[model samples]
Target chain A: MKKLISTPYLLWMAVFIIVPLIMVAYFAVTTADGAFTFDNLAAVSQYANIFVRSIYLAAIATVICLVIAYPLVMILARIDVSFQSTVLMIVMLPMWMNFLLRTYAWMTLLGNNGLINMLFGLFGLGPFRMLNTQGAVVLGMVYNYLPFMILPLYNVIVKIDKSVIDAAHDLGCNNAGTFVKVILPLSVPGVMSGITMVFVPAISTFIISRMLGGGSNLLIGDLIEMQFLGNSYNPNLGAAISLVLMVIILLIMTLLNQFDDDEDRVLM
Target chain B: MKKCLSKLYLALVMLFLYAPIFVLIVFSFNTTKSRSVMSGFTFDWYVKLFHNELILSSLWNTIIVAVIASLGATILGAAAAVGISGMKRLPKTIVMQGTNIPIMNPEIVTGVSLMLLFVFFMARMNLEMGFVTLIIAHITFDVPYVILNVIPRFRQMDPNLYEAAQDLGCNGVSAFFKVVLPEIMPGIISGFLMSFTFSLDDFVVSYFTSGTTQTLPITIYSMTRRKVSPEINALSTIIFLVVVAVLVINNVIERRNLRKRGVVR
Candidate 1:
């Protein structure tokens, strides 16, 4: 029976994960004409514009999430424990709901006859084009991923000892100084995790761009999706792009993991 | 002064977090076609939503997919967790990290990769895309979550309990069934719930993999694209309520357990 149960797990890992990864690596190296070529790697250079846009958008979204989530985390950290849990629940509730539905809700709010434009109309302002703009894309990204940013930052912030803050106060560190020099440094792990969580997924998300940015904003995720389901049928090129994205994600995660270790040492 | 400002910030952030959902729920009862006005409330949309066969069938499809995929993922993940617990350290670390890849990787990457794999298989082997392919993709991603949940519980288990069960003359299989299974049941339940929620809410993977069948999310996407209809709003409201209820129930159970253990008053 032990063997029976264990064998299925071994088989699952082999067939689903390891084999597919091996196939992806093989596809990344091979050309469409079935010849072993470095052309796929070279092809990545030609798609430089897509890669840049992906990084740029992800960076912008990460900054936005950090800016918004930091204050919220600070507030949660200062609050009583019961209120902290309630706030955390409120933050997480949307995440638990269908992500697609949340995106759809944003679409509704941004559309021509949507709520925001309607408010503008009430102010005698004409129908403003807010839906397909870069702002809309950023807004959608922040909305969908804010919880991911908040939870981690909150975790680290809550773990910070109050005595440290009191000691900082005794040493004449004012509120702003203490926050910048002490709290921020201590919460580096949460910030790093927040950035990684938001940046990695935000860069690869095509749904927000497709729904909110209205086909104009072409993210790397959309590019990959296009290769499969859209007009482009080049799985080789798609694999190449995926490999590049995976590498970039690994680089970011490694940076964040180092900070995670630092945070652990601080806690200890 | 700083405290007041921080409190104000908290309120604003909470409002931003909730405003979209609040608007969606309220608009479900709007009488007008437009979403702007506070029109007279009506249950017409909810009535129409229930009568829509397409939406109903899609909901059913989503439920079926989530149930089957979550069940499969839970079984596989639990088995993998138990197996890994007994393995050597290096191999266990590698396998554990590998399992977490699905969770850490972007949904789009996973979706595109699986889509490409299916297309390649279809062209090469003359296979078709349908329920089986969707289930395979879901299980592939969801098993990692289950394994992550269950493995910690297994690690935390007292090894002596298993030895005592063995000493009581029970066979290994019977001992594991009676002892280990009971110990890790909560972890299994949590993992199952996590997988179920993930499978139900997944859009990108399902969108890429589903050839004919439309899940609830896909249907919602299609409807939202056509027009901002109250039917979609009603559907969202229903889903929101159900999710909140499930979470509340889970929280209550957890709190009760904590209280029983004297960890909380």
Candidate 2:
């Protein structure tokens, strides 16, 4: 009887979710001629630079987001609930504007003759190139993804029982000590979720790198886009790169999940 | 000193967050086209944006697709959440893990894989890619989000409420409508809104699957690839205002609901 209700959803998932993943795997292993080959999977070694760059840039962005978000979220958690909602709304409202437009806005600001450069000129630092660099890409990532980090951390931190901290304080722990031993450990799941949320999009982001980093600093996402689009038009290789990316992300998430679980056990 | 530092830090973060958006909005009203300089304010670009046929259609397309997709995902997801809530532990876990696949997977993989599915499937069926495929893909991704939103509400619900309704002589269907629906309404609403937000903001998945079909994001993307005409800035401003209005309305409703719940409790 329950199955009857879920049939629509299950069938939809089968056709869209399960089948699409299977298609990626299939394309990853096969040649364009319909013949099975390991060549597609093996091609990951060819684009090793792109893969490494993606991971490196994404990691830096994720770390930066975490650093920025943790303190902000701590303050947010301490603030009044109604105030927190307003702040959250402020953070999230920009997301309502099209993401591409948001990213594009950065381009105009960072353009050589754009807003930032013009400001720099007023400060006697004329025409410092900011656009089309690795830093710019990381900046774009951090700018776009900081909210994803903040929201989860805020949620988890707010849910931490006040008494948990009180207990640590009553045990003669200082504020820093209480935070380190009680609060930080309790917010591990949020940290993990934040990491996943930031890193996944950062690594796979094409538009940010393309717009801000320029085409010169291509990432795995651009490679995949190229394969499907006119540049290379090799779905097999794209699928292979995608397959490798999926596995790498899955492995990272698994490790993070284990770490979070371990933290939960220690907290208990 | 600590409070001052905290405020300073938050101010810097807010500056970082709002700077680009401020730039976007500022340029929208600039009399000159150059992003570098500010001239006397004019609403010319905004007027141009209104007349832009491509932007208008894509805006229409984006809204309709978001509404239909979120509504569909909510219904399907709410049902799935209910169904899974009833299942034994093993099956429930398996189903949940399956649902999480799309939610957790990197979006590039999801986009490319779905594009692959459509390309192959459409060729076999001799169907062209357009709104149907676009909407289908959006719904596919949106369902997982909706399901994720609703499932927690399902778990938190008191099972005895349904039984109590039954004991009060309400039939199963009526009992579900009266007891279960009200309890899970917040989740369903939030799920709907989240799905709407995602569908509206989506670029990658839409980019891959939208062959000649332009949603608002796709349109903005193409526009941004160029020098980014002020029309885009104008469009962004309009879209921003609309979303802010919607969010304000949502917030008011949510607070009212909370107050009502508080009184009842």
Candidate 3:
């Protein structure tokens, strides 16, 4: 009876998610001519630097997101209820503007002869170039992905019982000690989720790196895109690379769900 | 002193976030084509945006796709959620994991795989990729979000409410609409809004499956490869103001809720 109601969505899921994944795996292990070979998967070894660099940069971005989001979330948690929505509105408003427009705006700001450098020129600082560098790319990543980190962290911190902190003070603990021992531990789920949310998109991102880092740097996303869109035009190779990325992401998401499992247990 | 420090830090972060938006809005009205130095103000770009048929049409396309995809996903997802909510543990797990697979997957993978599927499907059917494929791709990805939102509301509702409605002379369909729908309407609305946001904001998936149909993001992307135009800034400024307006309206509604609850006036 239930299956009858679920039939349409089940079919949609099967056609869209299941079949497409199987096709990717099949493409990964086969030659373009429908013959069996693992060369597509083998070819990913050549772009090992791009893969490693992608993960490394994503990690750096995630760490930066954590650092910046923590204090901000703490302050957001301390705000009054009526004012909280207004603050959150500001945080989210930038996100609503087109993503490409946001990235393009950073190009103007971080461009060699951009506004910031022009301001520096007035102070006799002589325009230190900030554009088309790893720092620019990281700046873009953190700027774009920071809100994902903040929202999760803010929700978790906001839910921490105020009385628990009071009890810690009564037990002769300082604010720093109370935060470290009581608040931070309680926020593990949020931290885990925040890290995963930021890391996944950061690692997978091609746009920020492309716009900010220029051609000198390439991430896995760029490589995958090149296989399909660039002169390479290798669907099999793209599938293979996507397969590997999918596995890494699947593992990361497993960790995310592990954090959610605690929330689930509490709800149950 | 600590409170002041925290406030100062918040101000700095806010500046970081809005700096680009500031540039986007300012450059829209610039008399010059420069990105950095804004020379003077003009309404020419906004006028050009209206006159540009391609941009206007794509804006229309983007909104239509978002609306249809969100509505379709909500219906399919809400039904699926109701069914899944009544399932055994193992089946429920399997279905849920299946639903979430798309949500959990990298967007590029989803985009590429769907592109490949449509290509293959079209080759077999001797058809082409266009509007239908794009909408299907959107709904495919969007359904998971809707299901995730609605299922929680289903769980939170009083389980026996449906039974009570049936006891008071209602059939299954009527009982569902009368008792269950109102309870979960908030979730469904939020789910629809989420789907709309994802559909509208998406670049990769739309880029892959669009097949020559331009959305606003694609139009903006192509613009980036060429000379940076001030019209983009005008379009962005308009979008920014619209979003801010929406949030302000949302805030007013929330404030009214607080007043009714005796928390604020």
Best by lDDT: 2
- Give the true-contact fraction for every prediction, in order: 0.54, 0.80, 0.73
Error of 3 at B128 (Å): 2.0
* lDDT winner between candidates 1 and 3: 3
The Cα error of candidate 3 at residue B239, in Å, is: 0.8
TM-score of candidate 1 against the unseen true structure: 0.92
At residue B26, candidate 1 shows an lDDT of: 93
Q: Over the stretch A197-264, how does candidate 2's per-residue lDDT look in tens digits?
A: 99999999999999999979999999999999757899999999999999999888887787766443
Residue pairs in steric clash, candidate 3?
A: none
Error of 1 at B112 (Å): 2.0
Clashing pairs in 1: none
Residue range A38-123, candidate 1, lDDT tens digits: 78878888878878877887889899899999988887877887566767787789888777678878887887888899988989
Cα distance off (Å), candidate 1, residue B188: 1.6
| Docking level for model 2 | medium
Give me candidate 1's interface root-mean-square deviation.
1.9
Q: Determine which window of 10 residues in candidate 1 chain B has minimal summed lDDT.
A: B256-265
| Clash totals, every prediction | 0, 0, 0
User: Residue A7 error for model 2, in Å?
Assistant: 1.2
